[model samples]
Target: MLKPNTLALTVVLALLTALGPLSTDMYLPALPAIAQDLTASAAQTQLTLSLFLFGFAAGQFFYGPISDRVGRKPVLLFGLALFTLASLGCTLAPNIESLIAARFLQALGASGPIVIGRAIVRDLYEGARAGKELSRMASIMGVVPAIAPVLGGLIAPWGGWRMNFVAALLFGAGLATVVALRLPESLARKSAQTLSFLSILRSFRSLLGHRGYRVYVMLSLLAYGGLFAFISGSSFVLQTVYGLGPMAFALSFSFVVVGYIGGTFLAQRLVGPHGLDGTIRIGVACLALGGSLMVVLVASGVASFLAVVGPMALYCMGVGLTMPQAMASALMPFPDRAGTASSLLGICQMSFAAILGIVLGQNLDGSALPLPLTIAATGLMALAVFGLTGRARRG
Candidate 1:
């Protein structure tokens, strides 16, 4: 029996959180079109995507502490404004270089809502309850990735890629209006901390020094690396290696989303009873199982699309399970510094994923070996780190 206001707030926060994935996935169908229209190489057009991630990671480091000092509402509104302007810039870019720059700026603007959105959640809840709320939000946010590409595919042909940016612009503006009108300030007590560079550095150092926080953050980074590997390589793997058309590839990608939705639902149900740590263990087990199965399938010469999609879907479910718990756990000890904590978490996840995306992109051959293998390796690393850290803490 959730309150109506609570439910509405969660929905709004979920939408805010979904913006990054929507911005990334929505224009994927237009990559080749963007390249051809701008007279750019495939790699150059791809930079538009990677740079957005880098900007996102970099922007979070700034927004988190600022929000902690100034409150969430102002920061969110500012971000939405920046995001809208950047979206327009993206829509009107004259060339690939301009588009890349606009995309980076767009991500910088988008980072505000994402980092602050999580901080808002931390402001309202804690411990296993926070994990449940996050899982619920994840359930709603999961649909964005599932549908963004399909919408992009439909829209890209109508106006040649720029239409996707227009859609994003409208979305940002609408969301901004919603926030300005209805969203209440969740940061009831703004930190008295200064926004000085040295102060920010000290806060970051303190959080990083916490062994539990470090372990959870590292686990999240590894999980995100695996997820981004899927994102960076999936289009090429499906379209080039498996011969899926644009629409077909988008549909296959939805399998991962479906798995995510299911996993979030499971996490929401289980976290209250099992606790966050137990839920995380279940998630890591799922991740390892899925990743291992995918590697074995690909290694044994089974090249069917279902073979790849099925196991990846399982892996995504694991991601869905792991992230909410990990995020809640990571920020639980930093109630006063939730904004900064959320920011660091976003930076670690996005930076690692961006680096992994570059690595995967560079190593692409005509085979699917690299993607699944990378995913499996990341899963194993996360599990190993989590286990070792837990044992050390107990010892």
Candidate 2:
């Protein structure tokens, strides 16, 4: 849309976006191996990821405002440098505790790009156009995690699991160099807002107080959490319950992402005509339907790996379909406060994801029960929130 060159810019942003999902998914295949190497329990090992997300969420508090104050480019370079170093540290960690610490720092640093990139986009595009551009960026990024586990499975065994960290470091540094050269400052110094801790708190309060933003964040948490629950529990469920090998499990998981892509393709075509509101209602309805089916399947005797995942895939498709409209509508009124607004959205998303993952992990039955129930429950909660919020906004 802006121009054909906009597509090129989206391509770069897509790679920048890849950093977040890449770090999360790439290491998953090696989780069991790392536990064996470090002599840690599954939950303790999971603590690494949890801490990374916590740090990622925490870092957003600082990074968003800093970029808003100074500019997008410098803050990004500084964050990328820190992220690169942290990734290297993760590779050389001597134990699980240290590994967890490095991951926290890594996530802390990664938060800069995630927060700033969105702000940068808000800097460049707005209104409905933002959603289309975001979808374009997401399409490039969305494909990475689909194959990352398979790639990690091959690389970890051949090069030892640490290679994942090393490769990530290299990728980060390369991204940093590209940013240093090509990325112009989108948010001018004059455009930058002075943010105190209290000011940031107020910004967050305002975002939460906004009905549309709150609903969108809730939508993300519930929908994205479903995927992450599957992510966190999949290895255990597939490998432990169904006895699928890591390579096999990774490929199977990759198959689910197709539904996500399909949904996005459909959503993009629908937005210009039906608009955000129509698209989101349709998406939530589909998600609720899929989630209800999953609940019934689990309640009856049909809960197996396929039974659980097949319907959950439909909900994921709804996520891809709805997220653009939901997010765009949320950020629409907060042009000046986009950074703080975006951070709250990220925090809500990750916190919900963390809770869902923990629930699935703690309730591990060496069966698919925990996974499907978790999925259905999250979907149901999201549906309730979506319905209530939709009515509230209309009123």
Per-residue CA lDDT of model 1 for 1-395, tens digit only, reads 21323888888999999889889888876676788899997567767878888999999998999999999999999999999999999999999999999999999999999999899999998789888988998999999999998888889878879999999999999999999999888887999987987998899999999888888898788877888888877877877788887788888888777998899999988898888878888888878888889999988888688767999898888898899899999999999999999999999999988888878877767788888999999988877877778753332
Prediction RMSDs, each to the true structure: 1.9, 2.3
Best by lDDT: 1
TM-score of each: 0.96, 0.93
Clashing pairs in 2: none
Model 2 TM-score, all chains together: 0.93
Model-by-model lDDT, in order? 0.87, 0.77
Clashes per prediction? 0, 0
Question: What 10-residue stretch in candidate 2 is worst by lDDT?
Answer: 1-10
